[model samples]
Target: MPFSTLGLSEPLLKALADLKYSEPTAIQKKAIPVILSGKNLVAAAQTGTGKTASFVLPMLEKLNTERKLRGKRIRALVLTPTRELAVQVEQSIRDYGQYLNLSSMAMYGGTDIEPQRQKLIWGVDIVVATPGRLLDMAHQRALHFDELEVLVLDEADRMLDMGFIEDINKIIERLPLERQNLLFSATISDDVRALSKRTFSNATEISIGNNNASKPKIDQWLITVDKGNKSALLSHLIIEHQWQQALIFIETKHGAAKLVSQLEKRGISAESIHGGRTQAMREQVLNDFKAGKIKFLVATGIASRGLDIGELTRVVNYDLPDQVDDYIHRIGRTGRAGASGEAVSFVAKDNFRNLCAIESRLGHVIKRKEFEGFPVKKVVPLSILNYVPKNKR
Candidate 1:
């Protein structure tokens, strides 16, 4: 259905139209109305399904219609896991709320706190922040949550995985007890449920898909290759497919750097990003990748959650993530916004356990495809294979 029919105001609708959002995604269609009614929510949706807009749009409408907040006290707080995600969420809020008088800013670590403090002094209607940085500001008496009307935990599952649960709990304790809470996650693990129970009262739970479900639009394929030849296989596939832009997922910062260097040696424009890189350099690499200056970006899981690269043609798993949930998020980097995308994984014999775990989480065997140059000669002996269903084997 058209966004106009979703009961959004003319000004907000106009901003969406200007942004070329013709219609709402499934998550938006389902979550927006409930959020507009000022109810607590627990929404689980896949990445790239316009999840950001689902919350941002309704939040804008609510903030615009509600009583305005008095000086500098934040009325809305959005907590994300990483600095990039905080910035992205703030940008979405600003973009959608441009026609409104609402003010917002993003605060995170790895940067000077004085600038964020200065911005907070001027007053903001919404504050998007990482939990650590937010708590720091609150502890320093540079920020207050007394006026918080709405609390949103964007990517709550990731926050839990990153060991931010304690920080999240501390932040929640500082907010008013009667405030509305919204929690969104790609997967609803046991920890997510526990956290939601603590943070949201009588929350309406919305699950768009089964937990850790792969995006249907993504064509997933697995290729078995020698562990030493992963880089070579990746380079071959990129060259074979003639991908315009690809994001390669690796497990470590050092691996990302090595993969980028290898790709560059193959005459491909590549860059790497991880926590080791300065925030400015990370942002620059991301910008260059999005701008098409870099044809390939090798990144650790840090880039998996909130990095939005438009029309990403391929997502290659240079190394399988240790956690099965991460496999879902890594592949989600591509096939976004209803675009067809490809996900290729290079699995080695020794990594069979990881593969089996991923298959178990996906509830089916990921189809195997042998690359022309990279062929599988033998099946790896995975102890987990004994636990697989006969049909799956």
Candidate 2:
């Protein structure tokens, strides 16, 4: 359905049209109306299913009316888990709310607090922030939530996984008790359900494209090779497949750097993004990747949640994620917004357990393919569904 049919104002529709968005995504179609109704919402959809707009569009429409500001008060507060995600959400707000008079900011650390403080002096209409940084402003009396009309927890499950529950509670405790609340998560795990139960009131719950509902539109496959032959195998696949672009996931910052160097040595230029780099560098890499200036991006899990490349066609696991859920987020970087994509993984015998956990969570075995010269020295067994995945965090 069109966004106009979902009760959004002309300005929002115009902005969306300018961005070439022809229709609402499934999450947008369901959540937008519920949000416009001013009711609490608990929405679940996988990454890249347009979850960001599901909340941002409706919230902007609801907060388009101007209100008198006092003591740095914001009308809507969006809490995200990572600094990158905070920046991403605020950009979407600006992109969609450009024709409106509303103001928005992406608040987070890795930058001077004074600048953020100054922006909060008059208050923005919408503030997308990380929980710790949000609390920092709260403690200094920089932002007032007394007048907050909407509270949105983007990637609520991720925030909880990062152990931001106390900060979330503290922030929620200060908001007006009778405001709209929305919780959005990629997966509705047991923890997410509990969070919704405790936080949302009389909310409409929605879940789409998860588990048995259907697997995402990604052609997932893996190649089993020796640890020493992994990089060579990747280079071979890139050349053989003639992939225009791919996002490769590594396990650590060192591993990320090493893989990029290896790719460069093979005459394929690549860049890496990880927590070890400064925020500016990471942002630049993300921009380059999106702009197609960089054909390949090697990232750690840090980029998995926040990196939104609309046309990213492939994501490769140079190293399989130890966390089972990360398998979902890493591959989700591709195959976004109902587009077909591919997810590739390089597995060594040592990664057998991790593979099992990931496959069990996926509820199916990823097809195995092999290169002619890259023979597996140690055979990797198929996934045994009952294997419990352990989070090394």
Q: For each predicted model, how many residue pairs clash, with residues at least 3 apart or on different chains?
A: 0, 0
TM-score for predicted model 2 compared with the true structure = 0.67
Worst 10 residues of 1 by lDDT: 377-386
**Model 2: clashing residue pairs?**
none
- lDDT tens per residue, model 2, 87-154: 99999999999999999999986578999999988878889999878888999999898888999999
Predicted structure 2: lDDT: 0.84
Candidate 1: tens digits of C-alpha lDDT, residues 1-393: 999888799889989988998989999999999999989999999888899999999888888865666655898999998888999999999889889989999999768889999988867899999988899899998888888889999988767655576678899888899888899998776768989998877999998866556333789988888877788888787787787778888889888888888888998889988978876788788889888888888888764434656677788888877777677767765665456888988888878888989987776778777767666665555445457678766
Native-to-model Cα distance after best TM-score fit, residue 189 in candidate 2, in Å: 11
- How close to the true structure is residue 38 of candidate 2, measured as C-alpha lDDT? 90
Q: Where's the lowest-lDDT run of ten residues in candidate 2?
A: 384-393
Candidate 2 ranges with C-alpha deviation above 4 Å: 1-38, 42-75, 79-113, 122-149, 153-179, 183-201, 205-215, 303-305, 386-393
lDDT of each: 0.82, 0.84
What's the CA RMSD of model 1 in angstroms? 6.6
User: What TM-scores do the predictions have?
Assistant: 0.67, 0.67
